[model samples]
Target: MWKRLLGFDPATMKVRTEILAGITTFLTMSYILAVNPAILSLTGMDKGAVFTATAVSSIIATLIMALWAKLPFALAPGMGLNAFFAFTVCLGMGNSWEFALTAVLIEGILFILLTLSNLREAIVNAIPMSLKNAIGAGIGLFIAFIGLQNAGIITSNDSTLVSLGNITSSSPLLALIGIVIVSVLLIRKVKGALLIGILVTTLIGIPMGVTNYRGILDWPPSVAPTFFKFDFSGIFTPQMGLTVFTLLFLDMFDTIGTLVGVSTRAGMMKDGKIPNAKQAFMADAVGTTLGAMLGTSTVSTYVESSSGVAQGGRSGMTALTVAAGFIIALLFSPLFLSIPGAATCPVLVLVGLFMLSPIKDIDLDDYSESIPSFICIITIPMAYSISDGIVLGLISYVLINLLCGKRKKLTLPMYIMALLFTLKYIL
Candidate 1:
């Protein structure tokens, strides 16, 4: 049943390989279980509730990807989307978490509708190859930046935009150790290197008085504080509408870009098209919808899924293993959540490097393409938002082509999108 469902032969991908692949994938991305609650708690949400929601949502969504999409991808409350929910909407704009969740719900439904109409695929095809590659590299830098910040290796400076943190600090020192350990294991070609890196760094932290033991088998937090807590009434307001659009726009491109890059690497793309594209797209859409209802941020396909694929995961069996890991995580919340950001920083940075490896394939000699791509690569981290980088790239790509007398290069949809993006700022 497993082989027939996943379309893989035992000779090509054995059960052990798939299980290891699944374990690697889960370990690579499991940091989300801790990170989501930390960010969301800034918005005054219950940390315990967010932790439970994150785990449950990821388990269900990843199961969908394994069963329906039959792809070795894991779903979770996305990092950037969670940051936007906490920092931008709740704290910056002073809106309630309920209002932010409503925006996410709306975004997910809109995505499902667009996917059903086949419009999402059209948008995917519309992006130029150069721009798509740039988006991936840009997101790579964004991920690395997140790791540095999380580990306290990068901190805000009053004079400069960012500056090095005190290397002697506990967090920075631990992060350095983690990175070195992971890098060495990766050089040795260790299976589950990323997972082992996280675990070893965590153990190392214990002696430094960082990884405190809270005892195991504690009861998981109830989702009551966040479950079905969205404020639908806020959706009609102007500020809330913008919030919804922002969430929708960001998730749209991020998910598509991740799917494209990871699939291309896994040899899952043929002739620039993905097999079972609709199923993959729907898996992401359904995950986001369920995540919001379960009191988490947008659930999307994780780029860390690439780590699993690299471990020779080619079927749903790998993803099913990841789902099982998430189910187990619920019982060991204290253990999982106890992992400090410093211990996992290396994995995030290394994953960033993987995401960026495709930039070598871009045609950098063409100034028009290179310039716009550079804008995308730099702006994502600078602006601290992927959607901002994408819009800027689109606008610049159109304007640069027009000025260079290359107006015929872009399609009508590109021009329309540029205009729409421009009007978003004006109106």
Candidate 2:
């Protein structure tokens, strides 16, 4: 039964190893419990409710990956996509959270349809490799900038538009300390470094009066505030279409990238392909759809799952363990919700560094690819819009290649995407 259900061979049970690996994966990525609510709550969602949603969605998604895909990967509200959901879709675009939820729902449905057809692979292939790497790196910068702002490490300057804040101040000082702690922990190869950093920072902040002491352990908060709150009034607008596309784009690549990276490390790939690629994509697609209904951002497979894989977790038992961990986490709403923004700043900064690793794989010698990649990387944070960065990058790629007599490099899907992006501006 275990073998049929979770690929758990009794001969090689190693239940202890799988359990430990699961717990390790959960602790490493559990920082999202505090960080996701902090990011999504910026758009007026109830922070407590968002915390509940984050946990419940993670539990559901990870369980799906366990039972259906039978992979060790865990899923949760993704870091970069949550940033885009709050900063770009809601705050920057001046849309209500409801509208953003609608966009997410659309994106989720579209992802399901795309995963069902050959179109998803075509779209993924249409974008150049450099741009794909740039998208991840750009989001890294964007979220890191957000972390700086939240910690008051960066502040608005009327004259210069942005300037450094006083690092000697209480919160900023604490944030700096937190960054050092997280960096040291990561350097030491500590499991759950990010979560441990957040907790340590929060504890340290108590003496400085930066972190309010909130009691831990409470009944799970109600998800009523954000659940099923979609608004479709603007569904036909260009902005809606663009937002949905951006959400889909981010989730697709993020999920795929993490799967490939973790699978490679776990020796789970066969003949240059993931063993259950379609089922894995379906797990992510379903997670996003259900997560939207439960009131959260896009749910994607976490690269942190690689930690579990490294711990000898080669079956769905590890993912099931992660789901169990999240179920226990659901009771700690007070603690997670009380984690001040300053506590999470270091995690965001470190995660940004993690995302930027892909850029090293990008070919810098090719001006055509490098220029567009650079534009995308700079525009995401500078323009304060992930969607705009993607649109600009695609348009620039097509135009530069066509003008340079390198049109052969552009695919049909690439031209179609570029034309649609151009029309987005013109219409």
**What Cα-based lDDT does every candidate model obtain?**
0.83, 0.81
lDDT for each residue of candidate 2 in 166-202, tens digit (9 for 90 to 100): 9999999999999999999989988656667877998
What does the lDDT read for residue 220 in candidate 1?
79
Cα lDDT for residue 284, model 2? 83
What's the lDDT for residue 306 in model 1? 74
The sequence of per-residue lDDT tens digits that candidate 1 reaches over residues 276-392 is 777778888888898888899999888778777767788888889999989888998677667887876887788778778668867889878989889988998898867777778
Q: How far is candidate 1 from the true structure (C-alpha RMSD, Å)?
A: 2.5
Candidate 1 residue 220 C-alpha distance from true site, Å:
2.1
List runs of model 1 lying over 4 Å from the truth.
7-14, 41-44, 91-94, 265-267
